[model samples]
Target chain A: AQSVAQPEDQVNVAEGNPLTVKCTYSVSGNPYLFWYVQYPNRGLQFLLKYITGDNLVKGSYGFEAEFNKSQTSFHLKKPSALVSDSALYFCAVSVREGGGNKLTFGTGTQLKVEL
Target chain B: DAGVTQSPTHLIKTRGQQVTLRCSPKSGHDTVSWYQQALGQGPQFIFQYYEEEERQRGNFPDRFSGHQFPNYSSELNVNALLLGDSALYLCASSLAGVVLGEQYFGPGTRLTVT
Candidate 1:
């Protein structure tokens, strides 16, 4: 079984300050991790993914995440926060092989970037 | 390229009624997956279609079903819907056989079961 966990239900950060949203996972085999952001009444927008090789991965909207194998973590981070960035963020995972890439997602964390 | 597209932006149905949602995959993509997202929760996989076949499925019951056309478009059908069936139906498309490929999602169809 593959599962993802976002420990925080919400994260509040001031504009122009750095921010982080934590995520962890468990999978029977190698894991493919992803981050997605969603606005109200809209579908999720892909942020970034960690397939392999690099521990640090950059994604759209100046977002990035680091994959930590030892800690089984993939935490989304931004150097500077923007009020526009406030939204619901989700962490998902799939097994490297088999399962047809069926993703298991976390409950999600509401990101609140205030000015 | 046009991203994934789903029809019926919003729908309202009563309990025990049936519903069908449509989806068109991103151009050049061959796989379509359906997900149901309940209020305040993450999206849960319903099933996936490839080559006009049901390739993968989640924990959903038999009442939840889908079909894929030769054009790679797909439809999700639910029978005897329950009030709990209300949710945001998301359609995602990705290229098959590409390990690094990421799924692209549509704006989603909101289903309100009363």
Candidate 2:
């Protein structure tokens, strides 16, 4: 089975400082990885995804994720944090199959950007 | 583009009651996927619909069923709801062949089973 793990339950970061949310995945094949953000009462919005090429994939809201194949980690990173960046982040993994592509996600990490 | 749209923003139901949620995929999208998101947890895949047929399903039980319309709209029907079934049901859609792994999500319906 394909699964994703976000080790941190919550991450606290000061405004204008660097922020990082770690994620690791387990899958049979070279899986497609995705990062999604959810606000208090909203649907998940896509951040970015790593399908095949270049290890570094940039996404919306000035966010980027580093896909490390050797470590099986795809950590979300941002150089500077904003107060509005506080939200719950989820890491999901999917493998393309003949029928459909199903996404299995991690428990999620609450990111708190303190002012 | 309206992105994806789901009906009944919030719903309340009792045990053993059945609830139906609707979703309209984004323009040009042909596949619809359903997910269950409990509080403080990531979304779990319930099933996927393609070509008006159920193409994939996750670990959910048979009590959860769905239907896809010719216009690419979808409906999720859950019978015999339990308190554990209280969750935010999400709907995602992606272009079948054009976009391999990209999925767009809808606002989701909040279902509370008492």
Candidate 3:
């Protein structure tokens, strides 16, 4: 079984400061992990994914995530926080079946970037 | 290129009623996947369609069904809907037979079951 967990329901960060949203996962096979962000009443926007090779994956909006094999964590991070970055972020794991991909997502963390 | 698109941005239905949601994949994408997202929770996989056939499914019951057209468009149908069915219905599209590539998503259709 493949599952994802985002421990924090909400994370608050001050502008210009670094921010982090934690995620963990469990998969029977090699994991295909992803990070997505959703604005108010909007669809999920792709951020970055960790398929293989690189432990650090860079994505849109100057955001990045680190895939830690030992810790089983993929935490989203940004060096400088911006109020516009405030949104709901989700971590997902992709499982292959029947020639298609099914994603199991974490409950998500709402990031609140304060000015 | 136009991203994935879903019809009927909002829907309201009563229990036991049937509902059908439509989706068109992103340009050049041939796989369409459906997901149900409850308020305050993550999106749950429903099923995926490719080449006019179902390729994968999640833990959803038989009441949830779907179809894919030759054009790669898809429709999600729910029979005898329950209050728990109220949520955002998201449609995602991917290329190359749903490989680990990025899947683009539509704005989603909000289904309100009363």
A1-115 in candidate 2: lDDT tens per residue? Answer: 8889999999999999999999999999987999999999999999999998999999999999999999999999999999999999999999977668989999999999998
Q: Model 3 - which docking category? A: high
Q: Judged by lDDT, which candidate is best?
A: 2
User: Which scores greater on DockQ, model 2 or model 3?
Assistant: 3
Q: For each model, chain A TM-score? A: 0.97, 0.98, 0.98
B1-114, model 1: which lDDT tens digit per residue?
798999999999999999999999999999999999999999999988889988889999999999999899999999999999999999999998788478889999999999
Off by over 4 Å in 3: none
Tens digit per residue, CA lDDT, model 1, A1-115 = 8889999999999999999999999987788999999999998889999999899999999999999999999999999999999999999998744437778899999999998
Binned by DockQ into CAPRI classes (incorrect, acceptable, medium, high), candidate 2 is high
Q: Compared with the true structure, what per-residue lDDT tens digits does model 2 show for residues B23-74?
A: 9999999999999999888999999999999999999999999999999999
Alpha-carbon TM-score of each model against the true structure: 0.98, 0.98, 0.98
Show pairs that collide, candidate 1.
none
Candidate 1 vs 2: which has more DockQ: 2
Chain B, candidate 2: TM? 0.98
Rate residue A106 of model 2 by lDDT. Answer: 98
Question: Higher-DockQ candidate among 1 and 3?
Answer: 3
Query: DockQ of all candidates, in order?
Result: 0.69, 0.80, 0.89
